[model samples]
Target: MGTKIKISMTAISIIIGFMLAIQFQTVKKPKLRDTRDIWQLREDLLKEQDLQSKLIEEIRSNEDRFDKYETKMKDSKEQALKDTLKELKKDAGQTKVTGSGIVLKIAPFEEAVLLNKRVPEVSPILLNRLVNELNMYGAKQIAIDGERIINTTVIRDINGETKINGRSINSYPFEIKVIAENIKAANKLYNRIQVSPVIDELFVDNLKAIISKPKESIEIPAYDSSIIIQYMEPVK
Candidate 1:
């Protein structure tokens, strides 16, 4: 009976030893694999952080370059616009200009008016004809009675008196200033106007048209009237 009891105790001890070995192996394998996994995860995390830092620096650099480029473009555009405005002002007669040209004087013949018993006021038709001839002869800028003639200028007979831009002009004698493109053009304009039929027509009306020879320099004042556009649009 004692031998049987001893054999049973040995069997129990062997079974307990086997079970402890299996549990220990299972826990140790998992711990080793977890250590490797943790190290790999840390390496990956560090690499990702480095990439993120590089991307941030690149973004900052791009923003700085963009700011500089934008400023340069803005400055360039502003300068271009300023130049265009200056040219436009000159062409629109918003500024004074000087060039070689001729001056024309119109006056009523005092003796003829008394003899013919007719008023010697210059007619709008006669004035318009003279202006058109001057333009044809290369007259660049023209002014009558200190009023600048622009594209928007209007001349009409308002209430028995010849008016320009809604203002009455002098009756007997008035001056017309003209600016030509060049000295040659001014001479041609003067010669052509001196012998034009317009002068003959004026003479028939008991008025005298006298033109001066080409001057070295003539100054034309800027247009003083407002330029208002009522109904005009540009096509695309």
Candidate 2:
């Protein structure tokens, strides 16, 4: 019985040792399989470093291209916005405009018979009619007494005096600068004003208005006033 017990204990010890050895081999086999020689490890490290460097270079190259693309798009959008703003400024009469046009100068007719009669001052109705006529004949810009005629400009008879842009134009020999679309437009406007019944009526009223031929260039001042947008909004 003692010998059998010792033999059983020895058998148990042998079995435990065998199992431990198998586990040790199982764990160490993977390590041995994964191990590399010294030269091979160095070569693999260099290869990984080269691959990392190449990836970094590729990333930098793509970033540079993206930066250039972004810059180009930004420039293009900025230029487009600038162009739109310039056109808006022009259309709003915020910038001085120069073009080929004509000038209409009006004065009281000098005559002995009309001297005793009250000299007819230019009426607001007459000025309005003249403006409408010029616009009908392709006049692009119109100014009287250095006041630009815009969409919001007001011309009326204020306090028995002709007022343009809320300022009285009570002087004789007043000049009206008209900037037309082109030389031909200027000529057309001039010819229309010369032949219109408004001129005849003015003549009967002892007011003389003379239209000059188309000039090579005529400059119109900008509308120097605050523009208030009361009832406007973007469509989108």
Alpha-carbon local distance difference test for all models: 0.81, 0.81
Writing each residue's lDDT as its tens digit, candidate 1 over 1-236 gives: 99999999999999999999999999878754445577679866854775676568659966875675567567797765666567567767778889999998888788886787575578888888888778766688999988888877888898888888888885668899999879998988888778767889987888887788899899989988787776988789
**Candidate 2 C-alpha error for residue 211, in Å:** 1.0
**Per-residue lDDT of 165-232 in model 2, one digit per residue for the tens?**
78889888889999987898788778767876677778767888878889979999999988878799
| Error at 181, model 2, angstroms | 1.3
Alpha-carbon deviation at 190 in model 1, angstroms:
1.2
Candidate 1: where is the Cα deviation over 4 Å?
A: 1-75, 113-117, 232-236
lDDT of 2: 0.81
Please report how far candidate 1 places residue 3 from its true position, in Å.
Answer: 99
Point out the worst 10-residue segment of candidate 1 by lDDT: 30-39
RMSD of each: 35.4, 33.3
Would you give me the overall lDDT of model 1? 0.81
Worst 10 residues of 2 by lDDT: 112-121
Clashes of 2: 0
